[model samples]
Target: MQDTLHGDSQATGSGQEEGGESPAMDPRLIAEVRQAAAGDRAAFESLIGRYQGEIFRMVYYRTLSRMDAEDITQDVFIKAFRGVETIRDPVMFKPWLYRIALNAVNDFYRKKRLRSIFTLFSGDREEGQAPEEDRASERLERKEFWGWLGKFLTRLSAAEKEVFRLKYLDDLGIREIAEVLGKNESTVKTHLYRAVDKFRCEKELCGFLKEEKP
Candidate 1:
């Protein structure tokens, strides 16, 4: 997987220029989303082409595994294709798509948790433990960064983790995050602040917070 932490802002600004002005989503894209919602297969493929990179990045940030992220990204779109017609407002497509992506990530972890429980009961060792030599290699740099991140996240409650990821990793604002998480804005703010305070106390992550200005 790519070192997504440093490239987040750039990925968010992918097609935009140096002045920070973002062009509006193409009207054609909106039309395509609506058409896809109405069961147009070709339109749905167009929508996938438009948003796949962004959705893949979002999943990759959460999973920290390129292969898992790719699989989950495909799953997200599959769900969207099945449920698109249920969407009421075409203007809300981006957020709606993101909501699906968030749910897919949550479901992925839920399944993983269940598997862990089953593994424990069966007395099975976990798969994919890297060799000590491989663990020390520079090839694992991104994985090591995720390990550091996992340590910081372990201090937060589940709610805090959801809010923090939506705010920082997915780049959603307070209102948007509240809508996605089905919480009120004040609740989202509370979780975000608590999460930030925890991060602020960690010397290893303090510089990261400064860079993010969060």
Candidate 2:
């Protein structure tokens, strides 16, 4: 993986993990990426076409807003294209792209000083009538869980927030998350444990999790 991220020879070859073609990529798509990295416009477009929907969903799940998510999604691809050469391991491109999307989200929040996740709870409280999608019981539940998460997440350090968000909400495995955050697997596990402990202790959310299907 380290070799792949560094040069054209590495990028142009098939990605082999554990002595074979990577389970993470289709061989054809890998070829297209290699071509694109060599200045093939159509190949690059193919890459973008393949990833757009998944990337948009990733952005939306984090931002919880269509408008901002759309904006950030576009930004992510543009950045990916403009900086494709900066990507060391083309095989891990999806996770790499997600990392960019996540960074764009963080930057957006820093600039706007807004917390979109909290917006999920407020829904229409300022207007006094919640959106139909967010009824009273649901509103109460979301607010309660969110309030708990605030205190819980706040207890975490910065790296813990990124690791927990990626591992839990994003459902990324430890190695994938390690690649994304540039951390080791054990560190990722430790953070996940700490974050989950807080999550389980959250008064309202604990019951919801207990009731949730496995």
All candidates: TM-score: 0.76, 0.65
- What local lDDT does model 1 show for residue 98? 84
Candidate 1: clashing residue pairs, number: 0
Candidate 2 residue-pair clash tally:
1
Report the number of the highest-TM-score candidate: 1
Model 2: per-residue lDDT, tens digit, 57-168? 6676565555677799999998989877665556777678878988898897786555445665777332222342354245565545555656667778878877777665
Error of 2 at 53 (Å): 2.8
Candidate 1: where is the Cα deviation over 4 Å? 1-10, 13-26, 121-136, 208-214
In order, the Cα lDDT scores of the candidates are: 0.76, 0.67
Worst 10 residues of 2 by lDDT: 1-10
Which ranges of candidate 2 are over 4 A from the true structure? Answer: 1-23, 114-155, 209-214
